[model samples]
Target: MGWFYSIDIIEGWLPATIWALVAIAMVVLLVAQRKSLKRAGLQIGIGLLSGALGLLATWLVSNVFVVFGVSLGWPVIFAVAAGFALLGFAISAAVMTHTWRRVVAIVLIPLALLATTMRVNAIYGEYQTVGSLFDYSPYPHISTLNLSLNTISVKDWNEQVKVKSRNTSNIPKSGKLVHVDIPNTASGFQAREALVWLPPAAFAKHPPRLPVMVMLAGQPGSPTRFFTASDTVKILAEFANKHHGLAPIVVSPDQNTEATRNSLCANTTKWGNAETYLTQDVPDWITENLPVSTQADEWTIGGFSQGGTCSTQLAPNHPNIYGNVLAVDGEIAPTDGSVDHMVKEYFNGSKSAYERQVPRNAIVNNAPSHQLMILGAGERDAESVSNIKKIGDTAEKNGWTVFRFTVKNWGHDWHAVNAVFKVALPYLCERMGLGNANVDFPTDSKIRELA
Candidate 1:
């Protein structure tokens, strides 16, 4: 009967009445032959083994059909049920031959029933739709400005450590690491750090200026954070080495300040004008010390989390300077009014002025030309996933090119963002005319596929 159902059910799957009848018959047969089956331990074991093999075969067959783009329907469903049922009956029969077999069966039966019930409940639960996970009722307060910068600096808070440059003796070394220093700007202050991985071939022959990718760190730290995180440095170095000798010179600048918990990479009275520092002052510092290409397409900007938001904001506003923007789980909205107020305070009590600076409004009204937008979020990260979708939708509606992905079963964390860099970096390279349109998968491939 199980074999018959397993094949025929693929097309005209049996009705509920037939299922009930079959179940009743199976129960009756098991009870009626209980005394005779009691001595058949070998038979029970064989039945269980055969049932498990059958279940695995059914699963494999279904997978094969799916791979070829076909549907197996209820044959697959009945096969699973019959397989488990056979296993349970076999195990029960084998245990019942022992002295405390009844006690074992009593416990095992309930457990099996409970597991089945939970699986059924979970399947049904998936159908119930829910509201947006990101919706916060009492929205967080946004601070546009602040009255004081009196917060005590942690004495033990040394700046992030730096990575020593590798000897690229195989290639020509054209330039060296110049001094790292801070520059006083109109808004607060700015720190400029540069790395010149010049191939020796450049200096020996014709000295050619190289492309540059200005990397930004998200909130809660400085550009030095990337250095402290050795993985990021290695990734950037590998990216630079690839595309011939056209690897970008990376600029890591400090944009941290006292008035803000972390700079959103915007010009603000609260955070002392980060936008000016990054866009204006840092670029000037780079051009002065380093042999960097002045072409906008030669420059790319990318970051994770808050830094991603900053890159998105800065790239579009200064379209002539940045050609690539990669944002991972960036907060776009003003929350309640904290961001607005923060901007307003920076601009001397002009709350309405904050509207122009938000990334949502900016992109919708004026999408940048020669822009490469990459956004990534995890399926498990409900809020970030929704926000990333919204960003993608906006980009699509505005006729902007965007590479977006939601990794399965990941959460709002760096691990997910790092996984996304495999796709993001190549996309960035393609946009900058540095590489062909081939997507690169990460070596570790940390993300899992969802069932």
Candidate 2:
């Protein structure tokens, strides 16, 4: 199913609608062909059995790829699913004597329809069209500040400007989201172009240097995934609109160079220096180019899943770079989901060396810094929620300010990720010198607020 979505053709409502129509048409045809009760019942049973076989074949193939760490692209997955469907239909037809072809149609048609329906349901109202899935947030309509590159250095700008409170009555407009290629000079790594979301507050004539948030996406994910998957931009935009357009300058940099490769956000001898690329090159690029605040306390490192795990290590390990962290569904320790594989591939057969880079070990051995962090997971995601709790507890025990929360009835997906932002962004806003504008958001017992 994951691989099936990679194909752009089946992405929108059209395919889903067509599949549903085909399913309905097949059912009608099947009923017309087999009017007798005994034959109709047999046909329906055969059709359902074939559909089940098709579904099982699809699942088995997809899971086989996953278990072997071989992810098939959309085209391959599509072909595989089609082949299995055909095989299932043929088998069902070969067995049945009367109305066998109709049975085949009943099986394959409904199977395709159900797959499309589930996909549609997952992202129905989330986006308008399939194309909108990749579309960026609405750009700021209002005119922005004309600050030149030579106007002032980041250091001078931070020292001279006072963090002014935003006007509550007047709503500031949204900011432009620009895609900039940040060169990885520090780590000498090849990284994807970073996306920068400049809030409306950054556009004043004497623009206040907004705080910086370095956000990351999960493994097999891109930087823009944060925008497309979760309503991070929308949530932040709402907060900004209420608070006179005051929001942090969010820079989403790619953690993994490729979809399949998991860098583990480490400067290992195995893969590229992803840790350095993120902690150093990313910040250096932002400071040199963008008009953002450079204070460590004003800086935040955040991500979901693999990126979240990376944030935990990046903040605690490199306190001078990022003073705060947001880890959503983060692993307790950094691994490639396999300890032995991680040790062999990245750590060069050194378990102790690998353990040294883990967040718990790093935060424990080093003297506690005044860094603040939020660790969250979905309530339904028991294992992850439990792990995140341990990570948060460890941080709190080490004298770090940590807030832990759980998104009720959600699991480790974009919905859960959005929930984290909805609840926790207010806390982030207050920390970044943007006063909470009393934005009304959903609060329930599912959100387990930890001290």
Candidate 3:
């Protein structure tokens, strides 16, 4: 079973255990009183019912007062205080007739209140530190859920910053041009844009078209944002300068939209045709403007996060275009969809629909060509690590060539993504038919190497 399912089991049993303990305690209390079995059973049932009612009242009061921020005013507080005072007086009168009963009530009441207070405080603290829980917690179950939710929020903020920044700074100047826009196909919704890097060496004796690497951004992100935010431009420059002026042209396209949070880089009704936009439209545009190799083996595609998922999906689907696919911390499968939901969404209301789009299904049914596939996840990223391992296992079983790497203590973030890129770049370059010559480094390197 999936780890999430295991968590569900724990959630179910915890409440059951608590209730069982309450029931057992009631039974012991009645038996210690030397009550008849029938009388003891009746008392236990009434106690359980009373306890349940008290809990329900507490829940309602807490929800109405604390959660909704509603005020009961001084009048209600005074009334409650007076009522509790009367109840205490009545209990004290009854206890005066029995010393042992008084002792039991005195001992248990304070302890119960203390336990309740501690439980409340613990829950409140957990909610307060929700954002930092992933960083603090060592428990895989809690950390995974926390990180996954945090990642989505972080990505949302990052995308907003990216869209704004890219529009402001990366727009090409009319007079001196370093960047070119690849126009969209007949469908205006889907277009590819390529950014070419001419590191002075490209205009050599026999100016030859350079190799190309396509870098994809995360969900709700554009390629321009990757260049602006991440050190894509710097990395390319370093790689090019180190490889004796052999820097591949980098093409980053706008591949995310609202309909599909991830886009998966697949052709789906929810998201506009991203595959056509990237594979067909973008390549055609690149071949026209950039002096880059058009050979299938010369093209390398890589992405981070949702972009990583896209790279995995697109490379195998259209192997003729992408020679190498590097996916960094990608979701192996869509997790939110239930089996029934999957059947409805993909298969005309049938489970058979999962046969084609599911990554494992595809690998098992038809293993694609010997395209270089590199999958990496952070050791601290429980969800991503598990998903990566699942993909690796599927690939291994299917006899598909795969390279899997797990970075230590890294969660699902840019650091892990960059780590994957650093390791995968050389391998990807080699697969893209780039010569194995050592990259030449200038005595004084201008670009900052990612740590």
Which digits, one per residue and each the tens of the lDDT, describe model 1 over residues 1-451? 3243232211133333334444553454456457777545454555576667766666566455443122222334345555466555646554544544444444444444444433332221211111111111121211221112221111111111012122122344232222255465544564434323332222212223555667655555445443332144455456655643334556666655531356556666665677788788777766665545677876877665566667767777787787666676666643324654665566566655566566767676576454666777655555666676776667656655676777664444444556666556665655554456675533332233321
Q: State, as a TM-score between 0 and 1, how close model 1 is to the true structure.
A: 0.53
Q: Compare the candidates by lDDT and give the number of the best one.
A: 2
| Candidate 2 to truth, TM | 0.76
Question: TM-score rank, highest first?
Answer: 2, 1, 3
Measured against the true structure, the TM-scores of the candidates, in listed sequence, are 0.53, 0.76, 0.53
Candidate 2: tens digits of C-alpha lDDT, residues 1-451: 3333343433465656666665665565456556555755665566556656655565565445354232222333444444444334434443553465556555654565555444533532233334434444333321343432333333333344345423222223676676767888889877876677887756554455678899888876777666666678898888777665677889888888875678889877777899889888999987877667788988999888888889988888888889999888777788775888888889788888788678888788765667887878866556668777777777777878877788765555556678787777887777777755465433322236422
Better of 2 and 3 by lDDT: 2
Residue 219 miss distance in model 2 (angstroms): 1.4
Q: Give the Å shift of residue 140 in candidate 1.
A: 41
Q: What's the lDDT of the predicted structure labeled candidate 3?
A: 0.52
Clashes of each: 15, 0, 4
Segments in model 2 whose C-alpha atoms lie over 4 Å from true places: 1-19, 36-40, 46-172, 437-451
What digit string (tens of lDDT, one per residue) describes model 3 on residues 179-288? 45566673354543444444333333333455667777665455544444344556656665555445566676667643135544645455566667788877887676
Model 3 off-target regions past 4 Å?
1-180, 186-188, 191-206, 258-260, 334-355, 397-399, 437-451
